[model samples]
Target: MKMRLEVLLVVTAVMCAAGKPLSKAAARNKLLLISFDGFRWDYDQDVDTPNLDQLAVDGVKAKYITPPMLTMTSPSHFTTITGRWVEDHEVVHNMMFNTSTNLKLPHKLTLTKSQWWDNGVLPLWITAQNQGLKTASFYFPGGAANYSGQVVNRVMVEPFNHPNANETEWRQNIDMVMRWFSEEDFHLVTLYYGEPDNVGHTKGPDHPDRKTIIQQIDRTIGYLRKAIDQHNLADSLNVIISSDHGMTTIKKRPLVDEIILNKYLNLLKLASFEILDYGGFGILTPQPGKEQEVFDALSNAPNLTVYKKNEIPESFHLAKSERLPPIVVVGDLGFNLNSRFIVYVNKGDHGFHNGEMDMKTIFRAFGPDFRRNFLSEPFDSIHIYPLMCKLLQIEPAPHNGSLTVTEEMLQLHSGGSQRAPVSVALPLLMLLTFSAL
Candidate 1:
């Protein structure tokens, strides 16, 4: 009887040591991702962004994170969430091709739940959901409509310009996020602010109005921080702020002339060619036997580099799906390509390959789970997803590169540990036990 009791005690101790129960308070902690679109890292104008600056000073600041090739809203947001580049997800731009179906119109593109899963990609919200945590987003680019086909716990879908127009929309969105934060069921929320990007695009980054817009955005950040404090959720919530891409002013002549393109169309015997503004120049699809001819025509074009699908840079990690045009064209600095003949030339635009280091955007994090007074070395935007996953105590979706500099920031907050052992290991063991049963 004594020997049996000793064996039982040893087994119980081994089990307790190997798999401990996680503190509910720690496991239920939250993550908030905020995207301040079109925000540049070097815009050190003395604005009213005390709260955002506080975040920078208190957490990690990722300097010089490069945007994707198109640098468009959809692809940038997707890359930030998915840890995959434009090509891998088949979403290269705000306007994308649904090659799964032979549809050309937006309405014909049915976004079913399986579509998101079939892509082999999962956004941070989805990952949180899989961990049995509630998730929400307000007006994220692709998040406007339910891509997953299932309604997220909280989703705010309204036109960019609605009744609560201007900065008020941003403030209200943050308010909604605060409400969600107070909920015991919720664990993750995402808020997107489009004013800086919108105003920056309409009136170049140097425009006088840009200053006012940044100040308003800064105030909104202050409001959000205040709300977090008022709700007593500061310590339990991790706030991550990032931007989709940076903006730039365009003063140079259009690099690819529409007329020159149309004139050369016959030489390549192509069916259709479209010139995207801000150097997203590409051939949609060429007629049979014209692939090589079109490739040759644009390969050596001045101020541009052309590549066939297979020849694109490996670093880009874009997919080889049919959504990608057979030929990809990228413009050099001080150049843009336009298909729509607008009467007036826009003074400001992003999405062009300007090769300017200043064009890199900003990434900052604040909360109990982040490091302070540190700057992440220049890294790609795709690195953000892995770091976010790690901070949330979840497994990251399989990705090519490791985590971003923000991981170092998170480690500092987590006591220089790779992860919070209690938060990570406990949930993993529970999940495994449930699966086994």
Candidate 2:
């Protein structure tokens, strides 16, 4: 009787261990989130992109993806990942400044420091990890930093000094990402390449060199596809290709004294401010009791619009945070806040506004989860975060986008199927069996 009871207990323990429900991690779908900085929606139309064109043919293509208000790099990128706008995510500008400490958090630090990135909201990587999935990042902004006291399983910060190294690194990056995918623990991945945006700044969007840069990236896409096929992950992998925001041509530079704040507001009285004579926009922080004074001075400034912090339109998502400057000034189309001594005559510029065609970027989805060869109506980029969460079979953090908005772009398998598929369950069960043994 004692021997029989012992055998039964062992059997019961095995059965219980094997019967464990499909966890979020075991059921998670694999995703590769790729960001090609400043790759505009119409860029392919301008340049021949065979790889990108093939991706469009194979999966859903959004004609143009609207970026968040301000349409800047750090803001829009964080918006896509967090499903929150610039104001909500707290990466208001590429360079975030803390008024209280008089500390400026530049782009480089924003990549590695928790103080710069962890603003109460967890990004998708952290959220995925909570559900048991592992994440890796390759040069994606915000991926290098600690989010809510945790970092991804793997992180590689692309060096800024070696800008030219990107071309060579593209092939290497694809190999590394494929390696992560082969790891059972790595369920989500992100890769970033800053090009055409870089070229656009120097050579303008229409320049031959900018088009060449796009072509170069397209070839990298082809290499990625070939590598994935070789690794037999073509069917299992889901790839999302996107860009932060588009670039627009800039020529006009306002004289330094031409700026209302520079012209009238006492510079010594202000806490901290940004006003470059060459760029189309700037922000200002009044010391105290000077909000109205700064606002009044910038009132009716030609070719520029100024707004008090509270007065900025809610749709822009610019006014709610204390991190925002007290006075925000935006330049009209083709105009920048240039000064008399130094002029900004960059060939291309962004941060104008989301409505501008040049500020509109690309969104193309390719993989098992998306519908094939479909062209979607232009949609907001924020919806992407929800789509990503839905694909990974994980819960998304509280985000502003509605899943219904992006539902049409996905296939049946990608939607509402939180249960682990038989394909995944079998492997998980085997692993559990080994663990029990």
Candidate 3:
């Protein structure tokens, strides 16, 4: 009789828990984070991005999302998902060279090589997977690397197996995302599109071609939205769209001389010293005793800022890594240190300080969980990690972000654009704990 009573209590508890209105945390069970590489916040302001604009009208949009310092691809992308700065995450720049060991990988190998990233910090994909939630990433930085011996359940290292893959490839990529939800039951999905940024780099940001690419990406988003509705997954899914960083027009090459650089620092070759270059930014290691000369020559140059390893701005969180050069030089709005052998480049670039408004990227979200037609106050992109955790009902790892800043972007308990208590997630952690028992 006692055993029967015990069973009844357990069943009653189970039914009550199941019947309870899902806390907002668990209300939205699916997440899709899509990154449009080099998507400037203002691109939609001028361009006819109907789908993105529609998302803003139906969901929430941020006025600006300040990226981490040295606004480059790998670092900012990692930051958005990890909620860690370039310093803590240890992907200091898109193109990194470790001064101590003289080790660096070419930019072409970034997506394929796990060693180039694989910092110990956990990205959201890994975090979700560790919790027994299935996660997938399509061409996102750090997706190739396993964090703490755990990896995303699925990863497409390069979307089309090549860098210069075109829209037809991206359209297929979108179809694959739909499949993830309908067939695979992916709880977390990350999709990446290298556009407007790619075109903006080829043709400056003001070019009509740049606008064309932006419009194309918008159509892609519309396709994604339509796919979700077609799959009947709208009530359970949230789509968070953002960019790694924005683009800026580059007009001049300030440090295009190998001879002059070599004169100041010995053996400044691409193999050891020249880490990498983007217009208005250079990451290079100075040979021992030549650090002074390298700093002096580049610091005084017109429209450039030079900093030693310890002197980087505190807000950037890049001061502690040995992966950074002993000397970092940043060119003003449109300048870069390029290889003298290179020519006819610098249409657009993005490796600039975060202070530059153009360096900021776009952030928009739409789903069952987000407030409608809301324009959120500007916030740092780092805050995105916590918001993602809330929407997906996962516990966020230790991160440098505050949910309070973005909680207003979520729908009220009754589904209005109003504030509610932060969603406290009591995920099926008991299942995780009891499986061991």
**Candidate number of the best lDDT:** 2
Model 1: what TM-score? Answer: 0.80
Off by over 4 Å in 3: 1-28, 100-103, 159-165, 253-272, 339-344, 413-437
* lDDT at residue 425 of model 3 (Cα atoms): 19
Please list all clashing residue pairs in model 1, or write none if there are none. 87-318, 87-319, 88-319, 371-409
lDDT, candidate 3, 270-307, per-residue tens:
22466534565677766666777777766655556778
- Give a tens-digit lDDT track for model 1, residues 36-142: 88887665445666766776788777766887766767668878877776767666655444433433423113222234323556667776777777888786655
Quote the lDDT for 242 in model 1: 82
The TM-score between candidate 2 and the true structure equals: 0.84
* TM, every model: 0.80, 0.84, 0.84
Record all residue pairs in model 2 with backbone atoms less than 3 Å apart, i.e. clashing.
256-339, 256-340, 277-337, 277-338, 277-339, 278-338, 278-344, 279-336, 279-337, 280-336
Model 1 CA deviation exceeding 4 Å by range: 1-25, 45-48, 98-118, 144-151, 160-165, 252-260, 263-269, 273-275, 278-283, 340-344, 411-437
Residue range 1-437, candidate 2, lDDT tens digits? 66555655665654564575332334345899999988888988978889989988999889999998767778888888899977888877777576666676656566776677788878888899898888888888888888656887888986656474267778988988898787554789988888778888788888888888988988998998998887778777889999998987765434333333455455566435554443555777776777777678677467678888788898888788667777777877656665324355477877777888888999888887788888989999998998899888888889998778877777654343533355555566556555655
What's the best-to-worst order under TM-score?
A: 3, 2, 1
RMSD of 2: 7.9
